[model samples]
Target: MLKIQEIRELIKLIDKSSINEFKYENDGAKIVLKKNGSGESQLAESHAQPAAVQSVPALQPQASVPVVQQQDAMPAAEQKEKVQDETLHKIVSPMVGTFYSASAPDQPAYVKAGDKVSKDSIVCIIEAMKLFNEIESEVNGEIVEVLAENGQLVEYGQPLFLVKSE
Candidate 1:
């Protein structure tokens, strides 16, 4: 059986490569990994018959998801600006995990549509293996949309927020 660290390293490596799927088996041990919608990843392993399947979060760059800007907090009139263009920037998830709009459920969201932000602003948080990773914006602009819902399962490189470049 492979150690947890080895499995994690393999996952990181596979995420960077173009190979969509990978499978390996030897001496009664088996492992399988595959990419799903956009960049989400699924992994399965077994040591014997009737293998047990488990869900694993994807690992991808944070700026890869492409999406348009649309925010709920903006007025309808302001929301219509430059929406026809497909060049708006996006803040994407760095890893597969549960996405949270705020630090706590009851607290206000860290960012919403129509909010101005800098390249280093914190947009949201992603929780994986009991660790919370604060996702930051890589572009300076006005947040025009929030693509991922609060507490939603976000895949690697999935679009979390859309920003209209300044």
Candidate 2:
């Protein structure tokens, strides 16, 4: 995630640029920086809030999943194993920002499902205040699931990826 100092720099750059709005996205994070006619800069976060609202109704229909209901009384060990089998680790957002999977529009994505990563590997980018910051993996693992989608706004501490740690 872009630091506060980096955001300040980006705001300064926006003040000097002719652009009234700047938007950046990677993975599922999104940052939208806007300059009003009076030249006042404002930062807005983008997320799946609208989609979340829509998904609630869709999930209601799944209440009849008898299999899941039966699993509610699972043994402690089995429950732990089931959870472990699902995800070994999560890559979370350090700050509120837009997530980007690649450096640029034409660039290939840094990683995808089944991709392996080391502790220092660059997994994605988070843009805050018009500045892009490369986010590194903190664990050695293979990506199991990408939780966020490109251009989605992610909140601080939001899970961005699920990794099966090595």
Candidate 3:
């Protein structure tokens, strides 16, 4: 179990560092934190007006969900719809490796939900054996969902994204 003080300390570190994303794992548990561009900017701006630090960390218990506004959080709900739909297309991993969404620290993510993809489109970067491999989409369609989080380990034939049939 995670101690309250430890969780609070981690939150402080996240806010202080310019690197908004971090991950750490041990034998028993794993912790990950990321900053949403809109969310962070909004919080920062709100505080700049009041001259007070927005110190409350957004953490909802029992749910491993990223904090976002209700409207911006539609991806999770839409993701469920995509899963339930009878889509016959999926972007599968070609090799067993760790999946990365961005090419480098300064690069934008390869793809996100609602992006149109083609058979030649590079949808993600899969790191295998210390090499970063660009994983391409095998189908031509709109990307409806991304199944894996950035930096998550993936296996061969794993369904990384669900694409609606063209």
Top of the candidates by lDDT: 1
* Each candidate structure's count of clashing pairs: 3, 11, 0
What's the true lDDT of residue 94 in model 1? 78
Per-residue alpha-carbon lDDT of candidate 2 for residues 119-149, written as tens digits (9 for 90 to 100): 9899999887687878899999999888888
lDDT, candidate 3, equals: 0.67
TM-score, predicted candidate 1 vs. hidden true structure:
0.65
Instruction: Give TM per candidate.
Output: 0.65, 0.52, 0.49
For model 3, what is the error of residue 148's alpha carbon versus the real structure, in angstroms, after optimal superposition? 0.5
Whole-model lDDT values for every prediction = 0.77, 0.72, 0.67
**Candidate 1: tens digits of C-alpha lDDT, residues 1-166:** 6655576678778878997888878778787877765665567666665544334445432234544455787787666764643578978887768999999988999999999999898999999768999998998999989999998998766888888898
Give candidate 2's TM-score: 0.52
Which portions of model 2 miss their true places by more than 4 Å?
1-82, 85-87
Candidate 3 clash figure, as a count = 0
